[model samples]
Target: MSDLGNTFMRRFVQFINTADEKLGEELIAPNAEFYVPFQSEPLVGPRGWLKAVEVMRGGFPDVQWTLEELVVEGEKIAARYTMRGTHEGTFFGVPATGKKIAIQTMNFYAMANGKIVGERGQPDLLGLMQQIGAVPAPS
Candidate 1:
């Protein structure tokens, strides 16, 4: 992998763990597309991605992501990870419960010209909330 690719990967990881949205646009390409079926809203471009992330943080403060797997081939990277957080703040209408939560996620990113152009992720949002007692599981 090129140096730019490595840097991009590292920065992406940092952004995720820290929830530093300002660091996003610098690493993501303009017009980047983002998708996560479980997310209630659409996120497109760096700014939109940041906004969505903020919403998550607002709902689940202290959210953190750990990179368990990172594989890169050419211009594409796939990452499998888990997220940790505490529901100490209002999240999805749930009152601050100060409950800790963890969830698994898998994401793929396509790099173009050394910047992320596309990203798709599968996040177990509802399952996480249920695990943390923030929601009731279906029968």
Candidate 2:
């Protein structure tokens, strides 16, 4: 189970980095639930997940996520990632500032039948916003 979880998380990281719809469909269950920040409703399935990726890419065309660490147990996997990108387009109603950002993100996933069935993610949005000049950083 640990090996499977590890392999699944690797593929999941690939999907995130590439935003490949085909790969996403293969890794994510059709009815998977994703609990994300800011949004009130859970994003459902591969399409929903891909949409989120698209939004990120729209704002940061050179965005990339590196899987820094992973811990797997049974059907659960916890991952830590470093997300880096340049803000080159509008995001969350804020105009681009051509600033670079690197933020840490943590996510917990539940897998079934070798596919991701659920995910809860926590990303450093406040830091990201500050880096991109969307929000003021504290002195």
lDDT of 1 by residue, 4-71 (tens): 55567778879866767678867887798888674665577888677767877887768878777788
Worst 10 residues of 2 by lDDT: 1-10
TM-score of candidate 1 relative to the true fold: 0.83
Question: Candidate 1, overall lDDT?
Answer: 0.79
Candidate 2 C-alpha lDDT tens digits along 1-139: 7777677778888899888899999999999999889688999999989878888888999999988999998788899999999999998988988999999999999989888899999999999999998789999
lDDT of 2: 0.90
In angstroms, the error of model 2 at 84 is: 0.6
Clash number for model 1?
A: 0
Looking at model 1, the pairs that clash are none
Q: Any runs in candidate 1 off by more than 4 Å, and if so which?
A: 2-7, 38-42, 136-139
Give candidate 1's error at residue 132 in angstroms: 2.5
**Per-prediction CA RMSD (Å):** 2.6, 1.1
